[model samples]
Target: MKTFYKYAAFAAASLAGLCACSSDDDAAETGSGLQAVAQPQIIVSDLTTSGFTLRWEAVDDAGSYVYTFDGGSETPTTDCRLEFNSLERQKEYVVAVKACPRDPAEYTESPFTYIHVLTDDLEQLPQPKITLGSAYASKTVISWTEVPEAELYEFSVDGGEAATTRNRTVILSKLDKGRTYSFSVRAMTSDATRFTNSEAAQLSFVTSDADVPPLVIAPTTIISDAVAFDIYASSDETYYYEILPATTFAKYSPEELMTAFQTYIVEYAKKQGISLQLAMASMLKSGTQSLQMTGLTPELSYVIFAFGMDLRGNITSNLSSTQFKTTADGYSAGPNYGGSDWFTQRFYISNAYLAMTGYGWTNSVWTHWKGDDVTDVRYRTLTTKLFNQVFPDPYDRQAVAAFLKDPNYGLQFNPALLSATVNSADGYNGLTEGVSAGTSYTLLTLATSSSGAETVCVNSVTTKTSTEAAAWFAAAA
Candidate 1:
């Protein structure tokens, strides 16, 4: 009976222990359910040219909220707001916030919130650096380094936006005669912010005087008949051409020429305080001779005298004289062929034929009747017939035109006709082969008429017999 009592007591102890463990678990669950977590809201405020401030609503149930600027290290702010300074210009920044729970056992954070900041400070733009290159009388080219984050450059001639752009350089042109002008520059970063204007960079340039000589084309001598030298004025300003005296060309030694050029350039530069490089000279050409410049000014009239100078300092007197007006505005010469008579005649003939035939000749050869192609068989036949009718013939323009337009002939007739010489041993003997001779005879008959045509026929026959005899003798020998 005692042993049975002992077993019952042990069972009761085990049951109590299990009940205690279950109660402890229930209590823990209830405690966890009572604890609360907090969420934080971020807001951006006080946007300024320098920087921006950020603020947030703190969560009541949270232990602390951490804020970060642009994904940087987190910082703790009790009032949920902080002021950040010295922000970059025209740049975007993100502020992030996260809430942390107070309970050590139940540590959890709310979702992160973001705030953006922008600054409008212009000091962040790069400083302007100016470079002056290639200055001439009445004009100067100025280049500058580009400013970072700048949308457009504000250029001032004297002090204005008359010339402004992203282009680092601009050409200043058209200044008063013998007067100088100053230039300055600045940059615009954004629609709202513009950097302080840079100090004025002085580029003074004077307009060339009326007496200043124009630029001369290089190598002086234009040897190629196909290429004509350009006579460009230093500027787009109005200028005229005048014939320099023949004596001037002969009297001016190399040193004199150099001195003259340098003196003029220096005078122009000193007036403007800017460098000037001679660009080119303007001259008029007539026949094979050219007239040197005599005078140049706006809307001025001048006479040009043609003259030549030998390297030995011998000058040819003025060969001819012509007058021209200085154009009101700058002008460029049109392409010219130097007036080659033969070339001009050839061009005229080509153009006239093209107008008549509706097709231009290609490289001196008629396009429609070219090469050995059979497509021009009609042309060949026409030409042959025409040549046959014209050989041993007198000159007849109408007959020649008719023969050319005839549908049965080609260019082969040209060679045949050219080969027909009365002084030759063959005379008109070979002219009878194919239509060449026949056309020559017909042309001769038409040109001389009746009795004259009959006489020509007899002469042609006699010439043919003589040619045959000559050929036989030569072959026999």
Candidate 2:
């Protein structure tokens, strides 16, 4: 800079000598035909890591100014002030400005004025604390302690494609189940040179496992009366599930849910007349994502609740659930009362020869019914019916008594009715058939409960024309 100033002073003196000695009209001096405008004195201010502002005193008789910065092309402007932005930080820059007379024929251009500038040094950014949470079989959440003045955070998993978030957290998905993973995170600014990026933070974590997999429930499909969902787990384990009215589900916390579900398991076992151990073993499911809930009543909202259970029926995992509302009746599975889908109750009786013969709608509880206990049979009535045809009004206590006594009312009364007697020690499910296209049908079945209570379960559905069944419920996202 000293060397540049020395040369500039010499040049100024040489120009003065030439102007003083000139006698011709083209001298471009005061006494000649034209005179040059005064050179502008550049003023620099507001220097920073990225940029600065430059202003020069306006020259008298000058119509405009021209200037250049950092060895860039000169930009002509009517305003004497200029702002240089988005420059590299901690770098030296040079600015040059020259004044031009309003009338070029009478006044020539002035000598160039130059100034050197160096921007302020860049600041170092501090590292953020990384936190790993909500880890599932296929995904995990990454978050960080907010850094003061941090504009954004960059994240990468196992050296894969990078992701960014203005917020403090991000979710990393499509991970392998029961696996460990490595993650790297750093804080940054939108402008790359504003502040030095914080050093990357390294973290290692393992997602939840089978016995402890966090149940992330999602609704895969929803209709007027049923909702199908899936469960996400890390390994194979049993899970107990229950769906409650939205208000009822909202009343319980995760801990409270665990306690309530515990009571349900015991009562469920007693109702099945099986040891609690056997009931517990039968309910747990194993899969990566099989989220579904059905038999939901239309126009009703519900929250499906589920949690991990040890092989012994002890609640071993935190409560995982989601909320959804069913639409108005379209097509549905039986039991419009709530959304219980069990249209056929599995019969459970041991050691005694049992044979039942009856012509009634409530298949689960008709063996012994005193007159007027008709509604009690309803427990067996509503399930998970059918048509406009005249049928037995099971709820009509007087009507049901008369119908059950008439042998003439056999299968002829309701030819569509179905009953299955299975050893249950073995299972039966090949009741298949052919059907028509674009037609709707209602199904009714009488399932005898273990306690000799008869229940009628109903399912209504319309045949679909396209797509395979498996595609509707595929792998989890």
Candidate 3:
């Protein structure tokens, strides 16, 4: 009898497909210059209560394909397979697809290959086979094989009011321990109207005896650069822990977090202890066991909290927490080599001058003017202006941009911008602080060239104020 019904349904669908093709053929041939391409071989692979899959042979020279489910919005795709979703449940649809060229100017579409498909009826949903699992001290787990057309399950305990759920399995919690309870379950349609079974499946179970909660020990060590810690469980049961910055912990109190965590565990676990055990194993294995904490920004503070479960189904009532600070940054000193004339920029404050003024420069010249801003004009103003004047043709800004982007770039400055001169004790060209008869001052010049050659010169300058001239001379001295 079932075989006869299956063949009759196939014959009806075939007849409907022929009629749909006959009507659509006229529409396919009526276009102006758009020649009809090859018809695709369509196959209906999968079907559900609200959707179906359609596949066809790939057409030669075709760039993309278009498909329509029951004359709805046309969707384009490059693949041969397409899935139609959100369809009207338990209704028949005339789905079609066609191939076309990529360019609109050269586009020529094939006559659509179509099929007739009927979604599974909600009233005819298949019955679910219920299975009972182990029961805990205050909980019992029940599961059912899924019915393809059912969206929810109707469950009841000991003739009580029916409860609805979208899950295939449910764990009844907070039940009286050592007490026996009867349970029944059935598949329900999405609309909540029709059910797969008129009579619900029945089963009985007894809760286990009382159990103890697992204990979690405090962490051993929390490092600065790498935050890590050790956690010990009372039993092999599961546990969970969370680490957050002090700023985040400040917003969520430990009590509030514990409540939320237990709520989630009760909803998902068969036994709270089992869920905690699994969570602890995963957290310690992935988060704490390896990194303790990974990707933590340096020089920051953080706090961590953890909860666990024992051999039975109990959860740790109180959460344990620990807080620590990351290490601070340190700057080490290095050699100070003066700037080159080939480069159009200068040290706003020369390393030699900075060293002499106790500005953290590594050079021994830091003995003079150990802490003074007397040479600010010479370091920040005249030095840059004089250095820039040496490069009449501006330095390559593009090269400078690349150098700024990546320090490892082979940075080379124009050699023509450099010049140097040296003075000797016999007749020195450089002087500490020279004053002309008119009260003008002499400026000391320190320029290093690209070839590693350095020069010293004393150029004359007129200061805006006599005090400024005296300051410059005093710094040079």
Please tell me which predicted candidate would have the highest TM-score against the true structure. 2
Using lDDT as the yardstick, the better of models 2 and 3 is: 2
**Model 2: how far residue 157 lies from native, Å:** 18
Q: State in Å the error of residue 462, model 3.
A: 99
- lDDT per residue for candidate 3 within 241-324, as digits (tens), equals 777788888888777776776666555555554564564343332222322554455577777667654323256446666566
Residue 280 lDDT in candidate 1:
20
Worst 10 residues of 2 by lDDT: 468-477
Q: Best by lDDT, which number?
A: 2
Residues 1-477, candidate 2: write the lDDT tens digits: 232343345434544443333224324455555667887766565455556666677799999987777668878989988887777866767666778789887787776666666655644355665645456655565556555446788888888888888876566667776888888888774443445456678998887675334666655455665666656566775677778989888887888888877888789999989998887777666555554554457788898777888767787777776677876534433221111222332221111112353211111112111111111213222211233232444233334334433455412212122222132322233222343322234433333334544444333334332221111111111
- Give candidate 3's whole-model lDDT: 0.47
Q: What's model 1's lDDT at 319?
A: 29
Worst 10 residues of 3 by lDDT: 468-477
Q: Rank all candidate structures by their lDDT, best first, as comma-separated numbers.
A: 2, 3, 1
